[model samples]
Target: MNSPHNPLDADTLRRLQEDVIDSYDEELELEVDDRILDGPAGLSDEARESRRVYFRELFRLQGELVKGGAIKRITQRLNPRVCRVAALPAPNDREKTQWYFQRFVSHLPAAGEIVLFDRSWYNRAGVERVMGFCSDEDLEEFFRSVPEFEKMLVRSGIRVIKYWFSISDEEQSARFLARINDPLKQWKLSPMDLESRRRWEDYTRAKEVMLERTHIPEAPWWVVQAVDKKRARLNCMHHLLAQFDYHEVEHQPVHLPPRERHEDYIRNPVPADMFVPDIY
Candidate 1:
């Protein structure tokens, strides 16, 4: 059997090493919480000790999570063709006037294509309902309509897979705190996220209702225990793969063609003034 291709040249290998270090550094930056590391003011001795233990475990978990080049390797090897859409909350005008399901129809994948929604029409069932963005009647209608809408999609030869990442309140709080503390991650926290944190119970109740109401045979909701970020990602990927009986397609081996040189052809040198200063 032919050996697999080593695509990385010396320069590429060096860049890959730098990328791995960068990834580890980013993970470390997020996991290092100042409150826990510095020992927060006015904390009891027992609380300080608890915080230290928590930080240690958190660091260990994060270490396990940050696998250098794992994501890049996986994506390169198992490069499944997929279209991703961020189905965020509708604008104020659309929320007031547009039908919720109408907007999603355009985003439906073509035949043999997989479209992964970052969020979906289920916004009405979760955030919109909990945040009072949708009226009670509108929320009730959404609960009534969604199962049928999904059923229709399934009937139309579209396979629907749904996942709900379940995180504990404590874990979420810690994540929020981490994001707030880390400048790089602070952008992830929105006013809506803070409000969601305050109305956690409401969101929980909404989730329960959504699952109970919309868990259909065609597209059942799969809940991933997402407190452990690494585990949740792995489990979700595994489960998603298991949903389809997919196999690798055989392909003809590729051969690189040699470039023909022309003696008459001469390359022009780029002007030194046109080059940007290499600050790095």
Candidate 2:
């Protein structure tokens, strides 16, 4: 009997594992607990995120396993590039974004429209500069490159729409607490999260620069008050979907053979093991 409390019960999970185990045998064993979850938010001057390192590994693994679903966009202008998404990289002495730009440039005329879950194409004035990823030279370089990149993208007909979902330290703290308490969601923990909290003001200052430096008339950035998840999801989807003029691609009804043509299609064969039911 199925447990009402469990749709995909542990027994079912075990069985499903059995089916996939043959295919996954050795690689599954190699998959160790990276424990890369971002630690929950804590702001007491003395409070340290003990669980941070574990979460960083977890978040890294998550980056490996899932890439968010992309919605295709085609505008009057072609907006060849939709948006660039990426996790902030390990900052180098030379550049926080040098490697990022290199990778992004490599995808020039992207696979399709690029819709980033997190954007890397621009380091902006916010996070990178505030966090000291670059000296004044790097900031100058980013500003220097900004106009040309925009011009290139504009000339190419790639419409750019950037959405920054901002979360306050207090709000993030609540979310972190929820994650910490919930076993199922514990996987979302990460060390970067702690760093982000510790330097919230720095990130905010950086974001302000990001807004000023990067926000262009041709491709305006929309700031969503991401305090509410439902609102944020709805806002993003509504805004994104609005950009495309997707006339209903009418899918014609599936055709079926004429009644007479398919009359023999139901020829039933008795299975040798199909035991005839015993009469009551």
Off by over 4 Å in 2: 1-100, 108-114, 252-280
At residue 274, candidate 1 shows an lDDT of 100
Report the lDDT tens digits of candidate 1 across residue range 169-192. 977875665565446667989999
For every model shown, what is its TM-score relative to the native structure?
Answer: 0.71, 0.54
Clashes per model (N, Cα, C within 3 A)? 0, 21
Q: What TM-score quantifies how close candidate 2 is to the native fold?
A: 0.54
Q: How well does candidate 1 match the true structure in TM-score terms?
A: 0.71
Model 1 clashes, total count: 0
Q: In model 1, where is the ten-residue run with the lowest total lDDT? A: 65-74
| CA deviation > 4 Å runs, candidate 1 | 1-81, 92-96
